[model samples]
Target: MTRPKTTPLPPTIVVVFGITGDLARRKLLPAIFDLYLKGLLPSQFRLVGFMRRDLSKLEFQTLIQDSLTKYHRGASSTSLKKFLKLIVLEQGQFDDPAAYERLGEQLKSLDNSLGVCTNKLFYLAVPPALYPTIFPLIKKSHLAKACESARAGTGWTRFLVEKPFGRDLGTARSLERQLKNIFTEDQIFRIDHYLAKETLQNIITFRLANPLFANIWNRGHIVRVEVRLLEQEGIVGRGSFYDEVGALRDVGQNHLLQMLALVAMETPATLTAASIRAARERVLKGLKLAHSDFKESVQRGQYEGYLNESGVAPYSTTETYFKINATVTTGPLRGVPFTLESGKGLPVKKTEIKIYFKNLKLIPVEVESGEVGNVLTFTIQPNEGVALSLLAKEPGLDYLVTEKNLEFAYATGWPDRLIPSDYERLLFDALMGDSTLFPTRGEIIASWQFITPILNQLNKLPLTRYRRGDLPSVS
Candidate 1:
């Protein structure tokens, strides 16, 4: 199979805030290096790390080098050195205006030196609290204003925000309002990295580009849709944050819901970012909230002995597992049931979406109840691939049938292919000014609108408890 051609980006500089943070060291920097290794970066590109530490450029370089060595030691030193040469470090406090002013001057100096209206993409890899302060500073310093650079379409400025876009509906709206005041809608990229996963993006292609699947992707042919993101390990060290955020906000509201949108949304007229987001918005808006019977429609659970974990409140009721049954009220999938589930400390770590199609025809022989048949699954983890389950007649004279799986795995089917991590693909898109995979404000608001009611009624519902490795029914 031929890979899609990547459009070459113009000369760009990525300014990463909170450079010393764990995400930068583990995911962002390694992804940047991988892009360089794949020769996907622009000819003239640089990385600027903004932090509060008082380390010299060399010391900062050494710090990143150590981290790279620890996580990506297999990287060739020759290429690693080349990638490192493009990095420059600047030390400053996040809330200080002088720091941003100085950083802006530095960026302007680089733009002048390059003789191009250099595109700047600021990655707010910092905590959520810093957003209110950082965005205004970015605008005030003239780093991302809707001036001649962005207006003329010669150069561009974009903000790549980290997830948990807001804690709830009101907070999300407030953040959106603040962002609107600073940057245009087109300039903001609210990232949920799961959307960039190879299989996730391929979902649209699999449905729209394939006649067999597209024709049957409706309520008439499908029974139900299930999206699950399960993990086996409990919150090891992030108890403080996880306790407050819970599994619903940590993964349910964004990742699982986004997957549901992709599964239930109507096909768009085109494949542009706007078109895709519009489709998602329509599906999200069509979601039927489980307000009156949320206790029955929604379920929440905490793992056994969760309160014994460090940093958790003794009487904490935060849910570590969340599952909801939702319905789409419009489009071809109107009336179709959809289940969104996510939890930590489950039996296994897996992320997959299953489309259970109605058995249009009866079997030639008797069959047992509670048996699965005619299902298509997009397995996103463990072994990333697509699999379809079909019934096949046993090779005997008697009329007998059994379940069989036809599977395609990235590791096995495309052994020679190298799939980039989610971060690499998303970072590349941000550099090219592509918002196709990023979450829009409308989508976020719609998601919150659907989830806020459940959150408000949490106090009324009982939080179930199970053992650490036990698997709870999520159907």
Candidate 2:
């Protein structure tokens, strides 16, 4: 495989909204440092952290330095020094219009010093509540206005928004409206970090680039698709947030469904963002679940003793687990059932998609039956790689068929790999003005549409409760 040549990026500034937040400390900052160490970041690039904390620029630098040191042990002090030199801190409340104006001035100064009108990527790492205030502030401060470089067909400005886009369809639409008023569809990126995972992106290339899988990736050969994202630990400190937004919206609606689309979407005409997103949007719109199909097809659950957890309401009915079966109405995989199951406090942590292909049942000779189906599994976590389970006769005698897994483990097979965190890849894409892995507004709304019904019916369905150390009893 040939690597794409690294094109030198124009000078740019990345402004993080929630600089002091856990996400920035643990994921975003480390990703930036990694990019810098790899020489992927432009020499003229700068990082500006915006938060309401009353910390000085030096304090903010120290905080980021501590975070990078703790989270990224592999990063060297030399590279860290170079990266830290790029840091700048600004203090401001999200609702304060004046703060945005100050930020605008700071950006202008940077542009002037760089001798070019630089690009900007605003990453809203803050809470959803702040979105309303921040976006309008950005618009009013003229931050969203096209930069001079943009007019000359050089620079670009983009917004990288983190999800849950909204609680449901109505709110999702409202957020969409808010975004459109400030930024164009092409300029807004709804970041789904799962899409940045190596295996997740590889799904497209695995299908289109390889004729062996592409030819049979259809309903005729595929029986059922299972997407499972199980976690060993429950929502530890996110009880307040998790309780309000249950498993369905938290994980099933976005991460799980995103994987399903990648698995079920047809081959795009071209590999561009527009073509790939259009294909995904088509699949999302084609997802069919009649109102009556909810009971038999959807299953909800909760881990026992959730109410006893700190920050949870007494007698909380919020589901800690969710599983739903859906069918696609278009493309070669139409009518193929997609079963998506996700939950916290499961037996073990694993995120994978299992494509169970039809077995060779028509074979004349009968062998002792086992799990005989040809299963293609894309493991996204714990062990990130692809595996194919084929039926093979057991050695020495009695015709017994067994499953043999031929595996490609990313962590092992690809030794000395420089795989970046999902944030790194996503932030890089946003900086480079690539929206391939980012979800579009249409895709977001369509996903909520597919999920809203199940969420609405969550109360009516029976939610099984199991021990924290065990998988949900619903299965």
The whole-model lDDT of each prediction reads 0.86, 0.86
lDDT string for model 2 (388-437, tens) is 98777789767766667898988888888867799999888877777899
**TM-score of decoy 2:** 0.96
Task: Tell me how far the alpha carbon of residue 125 in candidate 2 is from the true structure, in angstroms, after superposition.
Answer: 0.7
- Each candidate structure's TM-score, on Cα atoms with residue i matched to residue i, is 0.96, 0.96
Model 2 residue 260 CA deviation (Å) reads 0.5
Give the per-residue lDDT digits (tens) of candidate 1, residues 198-313.
88888998898889899998899988889999999999988888889998889988998899999988988888888899999889988975445777788889899899888899
Candidate 2: minimum summed lDDT over ten consecutive residues — where?
A: 363-372
Model 2, residue 173: displacement in angstroms?
A: 0.6
